[model samples]
Target: PGFDPAARPPAPPPAAAPPTAVEPEVTGGGSRLPLLLGGIALVLVAALVGVGWILLKQGGGAAAAGTGVLIVGGSPTGAKVVVNGTPAGELPYVDSSALVGSYEVRVEADGYEPYTQRVVVAPGETAKVTVALKPAAKATAKVLVVSEPLDAKVLLDGEVVKEGGPAPWQASDVEAGKEHEIVVQKPGYRDARFVWTPEPGEEKTFTARLAPALVRLRVESEPAGATVYLDGAKRGRTPLDLEQVDATKQHRLEIDGGRCYERWSSTLIFDERAERTVRATLERSPACATRGDRAPGKKRSSGTAPAPRPKRRGKGKLMLNMRGAWANVWIDGKDTGKQTPLINYELPAGTHRIELKLPDGRSTQLTVEIQPNETVKKTVPAP
Candidate 1:
């Protein structure tokens, strides 16, 4: 190398021509500087996106692993189950991905009681609820009875169960069923009977009032003197004072006078009541007693010709009770214009004709002698 400060080095040999500038591939006469810059920016963005995806994948994996499964089962297989107050199908419920926490579990079913409990579910752990339901109790429903006047006897279905019992008496533990007869009795009191039915465990009450005993009867006649016979027993003469007689009976009376009077038979009605009277009028016989025979009201001769007796006629009552039969009543061939159940009818004591006629040309007839004051009751059934 020769030192040359002389003349500034002969133009440095055209200073090695600068490397020829290479023209980049171009469109519309634009250089590729902008494309190069954009390529660099795209590479940076792709790197950032790859990093974000890796982070998201890690987070999702952590979340998926955090929660746990829940399994529920009960003693009674078909019981209904609810988890955290939300319906969870039947007793055997499986929730594959339940969040880890405490859950309220409830199991219920008909014919049995309900079961509820709280369960803890740790991560990746299975929780179960088992319940044995209890059975329900049986049902029942009761009857009570009360009577006035403390110390009285009470009978049920012909069985005497209570004597000198409580005023407001109660018969507990009795079977529940259909109607049963009940009777109450005390000395000198009328018998009281009733029927009652009760449901199971039900309470019913009955109250009764006591009654008195004994009834009186008086006898009288048109003719002053006539023997009185009550229920086939002989009492004193007619116009008699009140006599103690059975309240539930009928009395038959027979009258006979010497020659001119006719024998008479009559009946008396003695109902269950306080007081009643029996009256009868003697009639003279058509053949024996006559105005001429009496001899102008002169007393009969004392001679043994038993004084002329008088014929006596009496009246009786007829009571007809019919069931399921529609028929008109006829007496002595005369239309009474009455139907069945004819009550308290009066007829001559002598022979009488009675008939029942149906709407259809069918009839039933009977003839019989009736006694005075007697009640003759008869019933005709349906045809």
Candidate 2:
């Protein structure tokens, strides 16, 4: 029967499709299809994730590998190297992908001069630098000692270097461009002095000849009681002198006070052939042992010269021989006569400064004290 449209819709609403065919329950195989399909999808997603992680790690490692490293080598390996002002690790310097930069590199080795270079390294590039080392400087010299009789002493500066030979001396492996002094000396010989400048890697020679010193000394002193010294070394007693000393030699002469003088010193000088006489007149020292009552240049007698008197023969011709000759017979500041021809002079007892002319034209004044009936005899030496 055909139902009305609205009524039929209500009636048919409950008509569930009958469990048409009650089939037997499927086992695990039925659920296995959907589960397996879902599992396959999950496995695919995990594999994709693992692949993506591996790709990411590989990319990071590649970026890290891009960096600049510097390598240095020399004829002598393992030399100390410096970069800029910093001390980089010894020879080969490595960095982790640094930016491009310019650097100054320095290399040093034992017994070699230091070498420096400017280097430009780009990013992701390795730099290789090479350097050649130069040897250090040295100086060598030969010395020839030359002198008369070959007895001179050799000195470097003020220190003694060698003594008494004609030997060959060598100075090796010294620093270059230095000034050195060479001095030679000997007893009775003048000093030989010179200077030398050396160059690097050069061999040089020098010659030196020492000359002799010849001088003389002469000294004298009055009252003759002091000792004399030469250059603080004792030579002799005063009234002391020497001869033929070195001409270029320097000396200091000193005298000591003992009798009538004070201590004094003199600088002696000479030429190639020089004779010099140095004299000292001793005055009465304040510490003199003996005191004098008489003054200097004071005569001890009055004036009246002794002479032979001539007279007529009363009993017998008065025969007499006077000891002194060329005597001036003076009576009160007036010349009476000379005693050479036996002059007659009447004189009274008195003191006198008897002036007698000597053979050498020197007039000697003698002090004479005449007493009554006393005849004094005196002998005169030639001037």
Candidate 3:
């Protein structure tokens, strides 16, 4: 009855312990899944709060640096807008990003009185301006100037009126109750000036009578018949009378009496409507006796002097009728002692020089051939 260690018939393998169900471990709070999820949610909330704070700070900074807006609108659209003396743009102007400041605004248009105002702009705020324009008053006073000489220039208050054209000129917009100077001018004539004050709505007419600016120049040399020159142009023989010389200007007068006499020169000036006489005494040069030229008034016998033509023997009639103005008549360099409208005046049957002299020192000349016993008619034009 001894027990063998390998024998004992594997005593029933100790009942193969029953399979047991595993139970989850429990903390005092709850499962660990819920705590882990709660921790993650807290982390997410903190991140969201940090992002919101950063966004708020950035938005506040942006608001501090914002600009103002300036908008201008008005009647009379398309009118010019000026800000602080600088041209901004047309009316209905808008500046969205304008620096906030005080500005002087002005609006101007044709035929309208200017509108001006001052405005202040604040940051992030709009400054709005509205302008209503008023029309300018029309001038009712006028001045009419008529000049005696057509095409004369007219000047008012030192400014040319009716520029680029003639006078019979009219000036509108003349201020009432104000004295204005009117000047009418033309070349070769004296200027006419007038001062007048016009009444409101009054159209006053002024007449300007201009006078001729001419001088009567008579030049004579000692031994007459010497050549005379005025301002470098030949004016004929000495004892010359020039009626159309310009007044108030210096004129160069030169007298050359052949090669036998010394030349003389002088400067002459005359006033308007003045009669001036220039007398020059020429000296004979010693070479006059030694010159080999022909003697004075003695013609060289060149084939008997070509036999002078016979003068006509019969008389002829001449009638002169002047138009517009009367002038003194001269026949053959002799004064006729009569004005124009000479009917059937008797003259020699030959070519005669007829001169008409006006009162204003203006003259014209004509040559007429008279036929024997026939009347010659001539119409003299006004000077």
Candidate 4:
């Protein structure tokens, strides 16, 4: 009951406190806390330097006082800006903190020419560089042609480019740096054809001063005194020399040899400075060449009353027994809307173009003329 009074022999003198870890004193009063703090400060300074270097490399930085500025602008915004061969930033950029020096500024954009300039930046001042980019030229050539006469037709590479237009003609999107042929033609003038190559991005022009292409056409017939009609216009009689005829186009001539005219129709083509010869024999084939006999045949009557005369018709008759495979007929460049087997078809009194077009894209052109009350039959074979 009295155990707490003595406390059990004082716990064996508290075990002498384990000598309290007596450390050896440093001679220079060195402490690890200061060294550890210095190491942490050095790492922080290095990290800050690295971040500043990265910021400078990306084309901008917080500059000190008295530093120069660089201001760049381009004609079109959004151009890539490059300074001293290093990509800086987009155009219309302002670098407020840059060292004073001469910088090679370059601006580049799509579909435009690159612009470059050397800018001198002064200390404590801003250097402005304004550039206007040039638009790239297309590779296709543009050509303009002017002719003397306004009624001229323009043709390129044997194909008709302009049949009817105003005075001056323009051809765009022509292939550049290649041999192109130009042809200018008129009804009464000689056609001019020339081959030329257009330089890349060059504006080309050509003046087609055409000359007259005239020729003489000589007409002769076995039976003299045959009247000739050139292109529905009445010319002189046969055995005549016709001058000033155009040599470029084909001409149609109608020969009427008086009574037995037979509606003779033919085509003639004249060459430059050359004479054309036409030889025809006057004969009656369809009686279209002549105004038929005026007298009408009458039938005899047994009674006292005289026989009445048969009335003569003014309209002409064309009996065409034309037949071909995949054939077509055209009159004056107009489709007849009928194909093949034109059996005894009636046509008006004039020269008609009977064309037979085959499936092979080959066409046979025939000129026919039928007289009043005259029936003409022709069997055109396949060509």
Candidate 5:
């Protein structure tokens, strides 16, 4: 058996030479166990990093856990809320991320009393505040008015108050915390106006001083009975007294003398409240003396010499004093160009028919005899 080894049934092809195992190739003299371990560690590290990024993006860090929430609600829904002396928000408000602390809460609304409270907030807990507001009480004030000059009328809010009374007037039950107009007025004085707002339940006294707006003026002339004019307007005859004249400005005073004297004028300013007088002296003017002269171009009649004229007679003075009415005087059926109260008028000595003619078409006739160089005073009655 030992000699025929090649032919001994081929020996089952040498037992088919069992399958051989092949090992993986390793570089740098390193083993695969260490590499596998490194790969597992890298995968674990990447998974951990991804988890950390997701947590940071969701705002779930340490800071978010310490904060609290706050909510405010009240009867008046729109009331303002102040926390710790700082404005927080309006009523029915919610603050999701408020810091945990103690706060002084104040709720306020118009026409309502303010509500105040103390509140505390805890971590991860919500603090809710509820308030019931009450209506505020209305207030009134009393005002006393005093004017410089007594007996001045007082007006409040464009309506007369305490009329027909003196100063130191009082007005009660005026609304407080609102603006009111006060006016003080009197005759012959400038009006005084003021705006006042009083506190609740306050009694206040106000003083108003008024300035005089008119001046008392008396006008006189050297000769009585002259016409007086003020600011180109006829005021009256001379020796006139005016109670109310415009003050603090310049005024023109004029005196006119008819047919005998020159006109007098003056510019005057009255600034004081006292009485003032204006006197004007008229000058005699010769221009009015030739008023009855003939025209310059008229010539005398061409005739023989006229007979000698009779001697001129002496003149007697007539004083006409009229009572209750002023009338025109007519002598011998001719107009005398004079009115009643004509003092010391000269006329020739003779018996003349005197007629008193009134403005209303009424007349009275009398027979008057004038004596030479003597004045006849007659008191004429109104017809």
Candidate 6:
């Protein structure tokens, strides 16, 4: 009874089941086929992450492209290839295909004098280097330069090379083309030689000329009447032949007054080639010749005459003689030594200032005023 009762009522309600007719099964394109398969699975995961991000951007653009290469070579050919300082050219080396670096290579050549190193090129490197340039060294010899008056000495093969003070005189590193043996001497001159050939690196020149020296002087005077002076000036009596002079030139001799003559001075320098002759004789003279007499280039008057009283045959005897030039004598002022050509002097009479010294320095002073017994002669000229 209970079952029938409920079934009858529920049976009617069960008919609502007809509402289940949901016919939405059109998979061909219905609902856009799940939105087109979920948009093709999101475009296949964004096309596989965009093909793995385009293969990682093509491997990072091939690692930023920077290869390296720097090959170099060398020899004599122009060679002038610097790196750090820049000028990178000339030379067998210059391929600096850089970008992987460590450079510092220099190679210069002229006669040859430059070569440095410090290279390193990696990153796909192709480095190979080689260099060698050396050939520049010289110092030859062939000298002969001198001076002293051969015009001043400046020869090549004959020796005496330079001494003109200033001129086109250059005796550089001789021997380039060697062949020397020059000689040039001077004094009164007269000494020359030749032979100077230079050609290796080339450089040689020459010239020489000299000759002059001859002398013969003589002077005599004693109580026989003294008077002679060479440097001091006076010629005529007492053999004198200064000939061509210049034996090195330097003479000043003197001897004056005679009663017993005794006053001499000498200074001579001559020996260019040798051969000299001189002689002067005179004696006794203590400064005697007082009676006032000044007329020979004049200039002598200092007052003082009265002190000569002792002597026999000539009271205060005095004598002197000289020839040519050959002196170095100063009396009354000391240094009484040196006189040639009849050399003789002696005084004890009065005033006197006889001095003669020559050899370049030059000197000649004479002032005589002897009394007692006098005799003087002079001649001097050579400085």
lDDT per residue as tens, model 6, 230-336: 67876544443445555545777765553434555556665444455444333334443444433222345878855555443433433444344566677667876
Q: lDDT of candidate 5 vs native?
A: 0.73
Q: Where is the poorest 10-residue window by lDDT in model 2?
A: 312-321
Q: Write the per-residue lDDT of candidate 2 for residues 117-160, one digit (tens) a residue.
A: 87765557877788877875545554455555466677775778
Per-residue CA lDDT of model 1 for 51-120, tens digit only, reads 7556434331223236677777756787888876777888677878776666788888876778888876
Q: What is the lDDT of residue 345 in candidate 4?
A: 68
Off by over 4 Å in 4: 1-34, 50-68, 71-103, 107-123, 128-197, 200-212, 220-225, 248-252, 257-273, 278-383
lDDT string for model 4 (1-383, tens) is 55587566655555555557878988776778998999999999999888766644543343232468899986788999999898999978899978755678999998798988887666688899998899876578889888867679999887888895657888778878689999998876788777889887778889887766787777776456677898999898878789878877778777776543444566664434455666554443344333332211222334454344344446565544444345776654588777766656677665655655555454555566666777766666443
Candidate 3, pairs of clashing residues: none
TM-score-wise, the better of 3 and 5 is: 5
* Highest lDDT model number: 3
TM-score of each: 0.36, 0.35, 0.34, 0.42, 0.39, 0.34
- Over 4 Å off, model 2: 1-65, 73-127, 130-132, 136-179, 185-217, 222-226, 229-235, 242-258, 265-283, 287-383
CA RMSD per model (angstroms): 20.3, 27.0, 22.6, 12.8, 22.8, 19.2
Q: Is 1 or 6 the stronger prediction by TM-score? A: 1
Runs in model 3 deviating more than 4 A are 1-68, 73-92, 97-114, 118-127, 132-183, 186-213, 223-225, 229-240, 244-252, 266-270, 283-383
Ranking by lDDT: 3, 5, 4, 1, 2, 6
- CA lDDT of each prediction against the hidden true structure: 0.64, 0.56, 0.75, 0.70, 0.73, 0.56
Preferred candidate (TM-score higher): 1 or 3: 1
